[model samples]
Target: MPEPPDPADPHQPIPHSAPWWRHAVIYQVYPRSFADADGDGIGDLPGVTSRLPYLADLGVDAVWLSPFYVSPMADAGYDVADYRDVDPLFGTLADADELIARAHELGIRVLVDLVPNHTSDEHAWFREALAAGPGSRERARYVFRDGSGPDGSEPPNNWKSVFGGLAWTRVQEADGSPGQWYLHLFDDKQPDLDWRNPEVVEEFHDVLRFWLDRGVDGFRVDVAHSLVKAEGLPDWTVRTGMLGDQGEDGTEDAGEPATTDPRTKELGPMWDQEEVHEIYRGWRRVLEEYNPSGDPDQDRILCAEAWLPSQERTMRYVRPDEMHQAFNFQFLEMSWRAEDVREVVDTSLRAADEVGAPTTWVLSNHDVVRHASRLGLPVGSPRPNGIGAGSEQPNPVLGLRRARAATTLMMALPGSAYVYNGEELGLPDHTALPDRLRQDPAFHRTAGVELGRDGCRVPLPWVADEPSYGFGPGPRSWLPQPLLYGPLAADRQEGVSSSTLELYRTLLRLRREHDLGVGGLHWEGGWGPDVLAFRNAREDGRPVTVVANLGEDLLDLPEGLEVLVASGRLEDGRLPQDTTVWLA
Candidate 1:
């Protein structure tokens, strides 16, 4: 493999004619755990600014931050109390502005989380809706409905929260009587907005302009598949599980096996409604307004975090007049099997081609178990919510091996890619987080049946020996970091050629140099079912081949293929089990 370029060099700017997002590598920073500049033990915007140079050197085109908006932190920052300001927990608005400026100066674009689906119950709008009583204009801004049962004592529908429990929460009327109930798809503290209401639509449009005016490059729309519900908010009893009880590792676990025939089942009333496209169409217009000259380079992108059932449905959000990209959650949820991986890749590329959009590939995110730990589980094991001391533990060595190989395969694919905050260091979930310290709403709402995402959101380790691994000056982090993280810290891996960090740097650099993200994929025939082999070529016609061995036996490479990089060390010039190789 060629040695990676020095970390000190500046990035070559993208050409103005091409939209950088089409094949960009974007990094996700869950700000609350990225770095804490202050002694607060929680990450903030200033902390992100201090790390901008590191990201630029790592070769990502952009950084997408999880929410840092003013919030009650009920679901971390997803429950937004204020759309226009940074939360005090994440530093002031000035800190955000500085972070944006520093990122742009480093040639890295910035994308912030936009939670338009719901707001913190404490948000001024929500509070006003409560104060205005039932049947008032302010109440119309949210989804409020009368309850069923005697004296309106029962929830209006059979809907359940993704976090668990009833989706409806009744409010206390001013006269001390039971009032109309409001809808909350995730947590009671987060009230779902009524997209059918013009007032709600106008408010979000202004919110988009507010951040765009501050120079944000794009938005990662949270619950982007949501925001619009069925006209009557119908009850869905066809499924055996909770409506939004998406499983761990981005897999769909609706209690029963979903039918392969689309005609046999309908989308739940709260998810993937057709009307959501019109909302994004309007958002696309808002984004275009920022690039009045129609320059593709200046285009503000919107990436959807929608977890739809199929890639074909996912493609709808990225049509020419809608979002630029939606996450390929299907790829993320795949088991570490050659056939599964190849199948999803084929479907994903075809869907993107149909829409004239670049597919977006992601291995892990804040919402799922880190791939380093997830990929190691035994084949066909259930997608676990969280791994505790009593749970069957993943084989650390085996898991990391497959993780490296899986990520190598993902990077070699054709599309934009997202690097979750710490996957570059081969980070694993803090699998044994104690129940008392757990904060994810999924854990509490499910009464521990679902361990939730806190294990994956544990603060990142920077310096191996420093306090909180140098995440902050404080002696601790907001969420506990496992002691095992020391060896995998960034400082320990920086210049080591064989380290995971160095491997990522090499992959990102080669991806750009080869234009692989915009390349076409052609599957190679005559490979075993346990092996995946494909060649990638762009318009320039120079080809790069990627091969992964998922079987127990070693696989031989045909002669004359110049090996560029390998996920694991090759054995006697042969690819070993759970290894991936890039060749030219």
Candidate 2:
């Protein structure tokens, strides 16, 4: 639990010792919406390079950029057309190199998104597979199988796509006759790769070297749990196969109820397969090759974006020879309740402790409604994929209060944390986005039953008064920005003490100064059922106590304790409902 050298100070050189990511603050940058240097109505690599200073100033140890690989924009760049090249939509390879270099100069590590489970239909390999016909070696690189049921009209199995429709898509033979079908767990534009193929395995290893050679600190492995399937690709017997009830993120919620142990449930054929561990073990070797000295700063880490049935199942991904971290989705999915929060925190720590890995905490990302808005939804309400003009809206006032409080509590805990861009601005989801402007595949695939993740992917607002709220120099952005963004733009909160942006800056600064990230947690007694109180034991004798009040009633702070920072203003020296405070 020893803390690494203070990354909070950019002037200090990162030593070759202690793995920095163990307790680092990693910021997620959704490239298409982060910033736009060009007036082409889309964000590019140059746009991201121009914003490095902002991230440096935010005090994060690293920035995890979502996919900017060459793509046709189907699935919003998740369908990678080329693993080694930057998309024209983003910029040239030089721009990516410059972005990575500049980020390192500013004392921030850079992580790129890697989607290994599948590739775009336009990828060179997939295209060759299509042209090479049914039994070619190129076709063997992907999951190509003959369909069943007389004349092969029906899919081989009942597997459903996460987006919508059947998981298998039929293709016409070179002679214009009906041919074999291909498997795609997500959109049809993204075809799943057959990891069993030696070529497929070797190809990704080369891709890893390409980026590692280019100076990327690590990779955030997307859909890491689904790379390998059941040995025979059996049909799922559960009520909810692949297209389970939509999660808040517009993806499948395969997790069982929190009250029950998800391990008790039978593992789905399409997810958390046993074979996925072997793939990551090989990846670990690739990462280790770059860090021969085992220097923490030089270590290339892998964080799995796995949505497994339980923390215990998820822990397998971060075993000693596997990934370095896995997203703490249980905490992200939990409602705003003391019991729920405590249970997730306790169980997550216990599970990760067993494997000697750090627990990664995340509240929001590009796929889900921002926590600011989701926290406002009434308890027990159905989680919508996106909030449209006619959808039920969240209370902005209440949402921001809880969001700030939740963030404060999250930062004060042990282990690492991930901050999605725009969360610092206290931005809520664009709930009123018009249907005509929606573009997430989840929206169109489900025939609009699910609003999709477009609300959260809206471009960020940088300047309060400029065109497109300063997201770009142009008058318009790819996705329309709501007028409300103007008030919450970065400029408006720059130095405002009460603003969420300033609050985040202070928290990050103090988190490093107090050595809270690597510190140990000691639960404090006497707190009520609706309150969570714990002491973070710092290296110094001065320990920091974090108290979050989720109850409706105000809580009185104990005498002799100094209030350092608070999520919201205290009412008459008492903690207000849905507020969090740090005291010494």
Candidate 3:
């Protein structure tokens, strides 16, 4: 049978006079920690708008902002109470509009987070559901089921929360008795919406329009695989630390099977179901509706936060009528070995080609430990969810070396890529962050045993000698910046020729000029198993080969080519261990 058609059937496909995001360098900004404009000690929209020139200078085509919608901040705005408004904690709705206008002026598109899977328990819909009793119209918008056993006391299933504990939470009835239970896949404060409810479907379509009308370019759909649940809400066969559990490397495993063939996993009960595609098809129409009014250069796009069992499984997330791109967690979780990296790249490219979607390579993101420190862990050691250290632990020197090289390799790949906010500075996770400051729902719900993602979300250091590392004009930051963060501050590295900032700037400048975004990737064999070599052609067909040395010995590059970029200094004209070079 022939495979699905390219650009799945949208009522009207986004005009691609140039589908600019296809191979775009899109930066993910964790807003609260990005910059603080007000004296509130947290980053806000005003702060982000002020930093627009900074991102534009870095050469990113778009900025994917993490959740900033009105919320109780139960899960750092992921538990959204109002999808149409901005959280005062981040900024005002006006602030968001101004930020959107300013970003477009700078030629940078903006993609806001769209959390469709769940809503804050404080949402009006959920509140009404609580007041109206079970089986009411409001209650119908959510999953409200009667319990099994006598008196309907037990939870409907054996399902557990992704954060921890039971997924069902029993609410009191109007008569002050324990009533029917509701499902929450994440934190208890986040109630899962019943996608089966037409009200919920129509509500999100309106939410998509609210932002698109405000000039936002696209959406980074949160929990894209989770909006729809299995028809029966059947209990899943639980495994040790499975189901929303992070692997040893601090990457989301999503209870997948331990095999390469994603089909074997059959993770159908709660994730990646066939029903989810219809939801995207609907959303695609919403996105396409505004394409006529949008800048052709900035057609609205949808990128999924789907963590599937394999690259092949992930490929389905981007079929024409669905999302434009989906996060490739498999590559992020792969062991830092030359052969392992090469195999993932080869498979990822082949899979993406089969579906006609741009492959997205991401090394670091908000939920995982910083790739800088993760590379320091032993090859087979589980990447710690949070390093949870009271003192210096991971080998920073070694981690940064690998991180720099890894990012260079990632940028030289065939498709779009993501740069976590602090990755450009080669920031390591703050392993020693005090437990009391921890706020991730995972950490609190698990009583700190799960350390959580707080370590990687620390406020970034922007100035060396400034208070709070210039994260804010306030007295203190939301998450404390480490003392070591001083030297790595953006201010300190701004003009230093050898600093990480300069390296990123130079690389971005070169990447855009070479037009590598629209290029093809070809593997160059003959470099030993210790080296991964691949050549990417520019839109003009000029070739640049990226050679990364993952072994312990130094090696000569393809001779006679001029070196365009290197993650580390060249020693005696040979590439050293844990280094990457781009040759023109």
- Order of models, best lDDT first: 1, 2, 3
Which stretches in model 3 have alpha-carbon errors above 4 Å? 1-18, 239-264, 293-296, 390-392
Clashing residue pairs found in predicted model 3: 7-320, 8-320, 8-321, 248-382, 248-383, 249-383
Better of 1 and 2 by lDDT: 1
Compared with the true structure, the alpha-carbon lDDT of candidate 2 equals 0.85
Clash count, one per candidate: 0, 0, 6
lDDT (C-alpha, whole model) for all candidates: 0.86, 0.85, 0.82
lDDT of 2 by residue, 278-302 (tens): 8889999999999999877788999
Give the Cα error of residue 58 in candidate 3, in Å. Answer: 1.1
Best by lDDT: 1
Q: Which ten residues in a row have the lowest lDDT in candidate 2?
A: 7-16
Off by over 4 Å in 2: 1-17, 237-264
Q: What's the distance in Å from true for residue 53, model 1?
A: 0.8
lDDT of 3 by residue, 1-584 (tens): 98653321111111223478777899999999999988678998898898889998888889999999999999988999999988888989999989989998998989999999899999999999999997799899998899988999999998767676788999999889999999898899999999988889999999999999999989998888887888889876452132234433324454444221233445647677788899899998898888756665647899998877778888898998888999888788778899899878777877887788888999899988899998987764555677887533778898898899988898887678899998888899988888888999988877766788888998888887878888888658898888889999998888888778888888888777776666667777778888988777754546888899998888987778999989999999999999999998
Model 2, TM vs. native: 0.94
**Model 2 collision count:** 0
